[model samples]
Target: MLIKPSTAIRQDYTGLAELCHSIDEPVVLTRNGEADLVVMSYEAYRRAEARVKLQARLIAADRQAGDPTALLDATSVFDRIRARIDDAEA
Candidate 1:
């Protein structure tokens, strides 16, 4: 989920293994000031990576021909719907 420095990880090798087995989220390892490795439960990692790739594809699709703001700015629509529901009951 969050980036962890390698040194901190190496200090707790057993803990790391247990954490890897226990957690579905990836634990990133930093090396030389950059993210070098990611450790997670094997099956979980595969699934998460696949999802990430799919998300990337979706983002690419959005970038090529869609408005990113449409999904990002729906508060006004939500408020209007809420107001209509309140008025209907009144």
Candidate 2:
């Protein structure tokens, strides 16, 4: 984890931005010696968001798999997913 004083941002916004882009990770900024905010490249934020979404989907799938009442045959599931994709494309 990269940690920087909040003053660092006010002092060198460009350098901080470059560090975020180069590291592809978040930089923690502290104020009064306490953690305050996190800064990251927009691309990194988007990737992190995507990972969270995928994890949620996986968890939901696992729960559904263990529930007999929610079970759906593989063919039906795939057909419904494909239909949704087709609709999205159209």
Candidate 3:
């Protein structure tokens, strides 16, 4: 999908809803040269909105939990995760 500039959208909003419905994500609502608004399907929008809310709650909970699992080093995390998958396969 072409990243639509905000000006063009503002001038031609007649078919915006139809276009938005057909596409997976909302047309990029740009302000100036930068993207500002994301257009997406209603279900996608709801899922995204819910995910953001869930993330905030999760973050607050983690903070309250005093950073549990803080020693998870990324370098070894993949190997650890892969080991779990290997065990599952076996």
lDDT of 1 by residue, 39-60 (tens): 7878886897799999999998
Steric overlap count per candidate: 0, 0, 2
lDDT of 2 by residue, 1-90 (tens): 899999999999999999999999999999999999999999999999999999999999999989998998899999999999999999
Clashing pairs in 1: none
* Model 1 residue 4 lDDT score: 82
**lDDT of all predictions, in order shown?**
0.82, 0.97, 0.77
Worst 10 residues of 3 by lDDT: 1-10
Candidate 2 vs candidate 3: the TM-score winner is 2
The order by descending lDDT is: 2, 1, 3
Candidate 1's TM-score: 0.44
Ranking by TM-score: 2, 3, 1
CA lDDT for candidate 3: 0.77
State TM-scores per candidate.
0.44, 0.80, 0.45
* Per-residue lDDT of 34 in model 2: 100
